[model samples]
Target: MRNTPDQEKELDESPLTDGSDELYERLSLKVDKGQEPLRIDKFLVQRIENASRNKIQKALEAGMVLVNNKQVQPNYKIRPLDEIVMYSDKEAHGEEIIPEELPLNIEYEDDDVMIINKPPGLVVHPASGNYSGTLINGVAWYLLQKNKELSEQDLPRWGLVHRIDKNTSGLMVLAKTEKAVRSLAKQFFDHTVKRQYMALVWGDLVEDSGTIVAHVGRHQRFRKLFDAYPEGDHGKEAITHYKVLERFGYVTLVQCVLETGRTHQIRVHMQHIGHPLFNDDTYGGDKIVKGTVFSKYRQFVDNCFAVCPRHALHAKTIGFVHPATGKDMLFESELPADMREVIAKWRNYIANRLA
Candidate 1:
């Protein structure tokens, strides 16, 4: 997502002058099973550090509090296992980025944007203990190498329009110019970008093609993890349309097209539907959620896990309008060697069973 001369001209007259920044606020809490009933606002005020009852009430009035993915009133009673989420529009802060020289898998680049095919385990940007060796750091160095006197603050997000998880390999676009950033960010916000992911989830999906509609937000208890609220009582709306591609009795390969870009949308939605991505340790796919308990079967699954060693998900296809060219752009990547090898192993295992 980059800007061009034409894009610069278009930006001056674009109608998207207002509300270009992504709106986000988050505070999720999973009620303890042993907790007794209490007013939700009171409960949140007690738990949320520096939270005031008046502010909590205001947030509730603003429809910013959710219980189990559905908006709730301040008087709502908190129940055990109830997932609560509260959010604001204030932007979260991040560490000042530093440039690194890590290698990047560049797929396409232009004056306004760069499309990268990120490998698994490589974080997209810096955070916490990971202030260096991130994709943005490398991108900074790349720009520096090109004699673009860029600084850590030159691009707050280092031109990243969007990002994938640390362990999820995929295609991502980075805007190289402010105009491109605004244009691309608007597209993402408007849900005009086409993004598809390939995932190997546990079990055979009942339907060939369907959409998973849920509200996705942080897990009530596991602050680091996310959960899907099918009851539509808790989080922001998230939609994932999936079509079955291939099936191996115990596992299935599917194409998931995202209608909404929530954190871990595919992973959370798939898991909510009872098919966590294979080898996804975070969402409980690392364990055997399906299949037989036989020793040989266990060994076979173990081998497959070793082959991939991470969640069996890949961002395979991405389509978007170029910021500079104002033309539709589509990019696709083949399944990684690890995923391919594991799929082959499953094929052979099934075949040998028949033989």
Candidate 2:
């Protein structure tokens, strides 16, 4: 939500020339001890007449507001004797579009970067069908009201470094400045950024630990999916290292590390090894496993099989050097409820069958 260069330039050229067009009312307030911080928009709403949250947010993003001479985020806490300035422009009012407040799970943050625990089913950015309520939009509103400043080209992103699949839940990092963005992007491209994942796959793996080295490319038959082979023109080298954590009667829990990132690298590689992730229909597991004994125990198996909504994969760990300070940083996310439920069901099935 910071003022981009374009917005700042526009503000400087206009400079609240007419008092009639200026809607902001300047005020100073004392922050009481033990008072919880209020959102800038909420505070402004209470103080200003007929000012919508969206208007306050846009005004803040246009650099029309200052907190003690420093532009702070919309959600910034107010201390005692804090000076607040609001710059109002009628031109900006027409363009002030209010975005929805989507749910976000922010794990860690500082001036330079922020780390978020992105849950499954949430798109990272807005697309054609999904125009509102994406992570980027939320971050935009979050930053704008915080009174941060950014350049026009970087306005869409407040230092976003990389992305994960919409269906994949895990920890992701965002940059707060252009410098950090470039630094982190270079780290990812140079293969210095480490990422690890946890998955539950069908069948017991033969090896306790091993690596998968193959060339991966889009499937010839299915454009949506990727396939692996020994040779191909479009193929890119992909490597995955996996360690078996536990074994159910038919399924196994695994931890995988990526040496080279490709589209669906883990899922494709696991499927290539005859261990397609449980409930993964994209790589072919739509129907329940069938057999003579399976027919007899179909009901029991179906209950366990229904646990996973999609592929049972979770990004568990990430490591990288700090883009700004050059310090090493690592983050980890525990298994989500859905994945845990899948494991629990598998355990029950195994115990009952073995017993």
Candidate 3:
């Protein structure tokens, strides 16, 4: 189990620095029937790759560890089929950051901009509850190591152009200087930056292509979630264009192009269209919103969830004009192993089911 960013609430903000990145980790595990009673801390150590026994104990102390939806002690024994969830917020609200040497997947970099392949579990910047071990902290460390002349005081202006959702793996370009930052931010603001995402949504879209124009704002009831106003009565103007790429009977893979990058735009827009991205828990895609009720089908869907535990979305492609060189640059990433494997599983399941 790789360390994962289980949830990112990027409402009314950039993907990377949504005003102090929030760490919202959501995890679920099903204990097998044959398992004997074991301490909850011991049980979790095996399922969560990065979770240490110490971490589990800490969670137990903080009331973050729950068994069968109820908070439990560290000594709580795991009964068969116990549902467990570990939710905690390590909020860091300091202006200063302590740099940690985190691994970075650098795709391309130059004097002006750096294109990075952000992993699924990394927050882009420091904020309340997540001041350390963020992408920014790592970048600061990397820069300080590379250039002996610069001080840590220069760390705040890393020239972040835009942000991708924490769990959304994809390409992101960061500005290395103030000039680059201004230029890239202008490009994003003008909607000239070409960006495309691959998403697996719950239901097969009725149209092969369409545009979603709505006023997206905070949900009146669920403040944690966003709602789209199609009537123009409220919210901010947002537009998303989508094209169906492949249909897997129950869920359809689609390419979403952003005309405007509002907070949670893709997730909210797709949900507004009745085709929420698969496994997006914040938007109600975690449950079996599609497919049949048979136990076999249920098992198949559950396997898919386990296969790609995060949202079925990737920042696949991004294009922009170079801020320094005045050249056009485009970067694309192949589907990650998890997304590819699950899509293949669904493809095979559909083929055999239809056959």
Candidate 4:
């Protein structure tokens, strides 16, 4: 319920700043000194009062269960003196939202839903170390300006149906009413919502179109970052279909369609195939991953990075059924200036190289 376009039951609910997912500790316990070796899921069910096995399994699969500060599978055997921690994605409700007079690019709004073209570097919701200056605070202010009464209890997650990463620029839909919340949530949960993203990757894609099937989960070493488990041995299933839109010699522009909207799905999937997003520092695309080894080439890439400081990704298109009208609604946005400028530089660089 925290944030996502999919119905994934895990602690990684929403995309946060730096593409990290915020997790809240729900339970912590240490195994007995002489405890028998049992599956962690079973151990939790037996020890935790009023907790069901199903819930424990869900947490384990979601990487919410950590043993000795490490993520483990549900079948992991509990050892003596094992420190276990469980986390939940549920946000603390009733937190007072401070309304801010931030500018909002409201594309479409009505009694049911409000479509916003969120700019880059704007956080969708407030999290730790970011109590204000977020899109949700602006939304609160906008609603209050219209003289609409807001109750945190009634409007969960600040009426945010889903979210993209803070550094990723894109279109987002917010629920304006309780009915819209339930309806849009159902659409996302059912995976009926359509989302497309534009990304500039480091390498030239050989295939015109392809599908990437992997399990996306938090990286074992870098807990804040995510990785793709191509073997499907870890994490939840994620699928991304990408088509090559344009090809520069060193980089390529691609359009990604999400089949399952896991956190950092497109980023992880593209990185898994050795084509990390251009300038995406978290996924290891900040440095030059392609191009010649000449210093001039290095300087060129550095200039491009300066032009587009963040990851070169944009939520260019989103389509979903109108909650109240019961009609299909589609919205599209052009690439931001930074991304456009960077692409233009690449075009010039490639043309000169060919000449």
TM-score of each: 0.74, 0.68, 0.73, 0.75
Put down candidate 4 lDDT per residue, 1-355, tens digits, no spaces. 1222231222232333233222222456766688789999888777665668887897677566779978799999999988876654344444667788899999898888889999999998887778799999888888777866755443335367678889999899887764565566556655678999999999989899999998888888888788899898767778899999999978999999987777888989999999999999999999989877789889999999999999999999999999788999999998999999999999998898799
Give candidate 2 misplaced runs (Cα > 4 Å): 1-99, 148-158, 289-296
Tens digits of lDDT, candidate 3, 80-118? 877776653333234786767889899998888888898
Residue pairs with colliding backbones in model 1 are 2-112, 30-220, 68-233, 68-234, 69-233, 69-234, 69-235, 70-233, 70-234
**Better candidate number, 2 or 4, judged by TM-score:** 4
Q: Pick out the ten consecutive residues of candidate 4 with the lowest summed lDDT.
A: 1-10
lDDT of 4: 0.80
Among all windows of 10 consecutive residues in model 1, the one with the lowest summed lDDT is 12-21
In model 2, the Cα lDDT at residue 58 comes to 68
Better of 1 and 3 by TM-score: 1
> lDDT tens digits, residues 1-355, model 2?
3334543332222111121111222333333354457776677776655678887786666455668767777777676556665544323222222345667788888877888888877777665567666787777777666765643334434345566667778888887864565456545545667889999887888899999987777777876678887564555667889999999857899999987666677888888988888777787644454333556566655666666677788888888888678889999889999889989987887788789
Per TM-score, the best of the predicted structures is 4
lDDT of 4 at 115: 90
Q: List the global CA lDDT of all models.
A: 0.79, 0.68, 0.77, 0.80
Q: Candidate 2, TM-score vs. the true structure? A: 0.68
**Between candidates 2 and 3, the TM-score winner:** 3
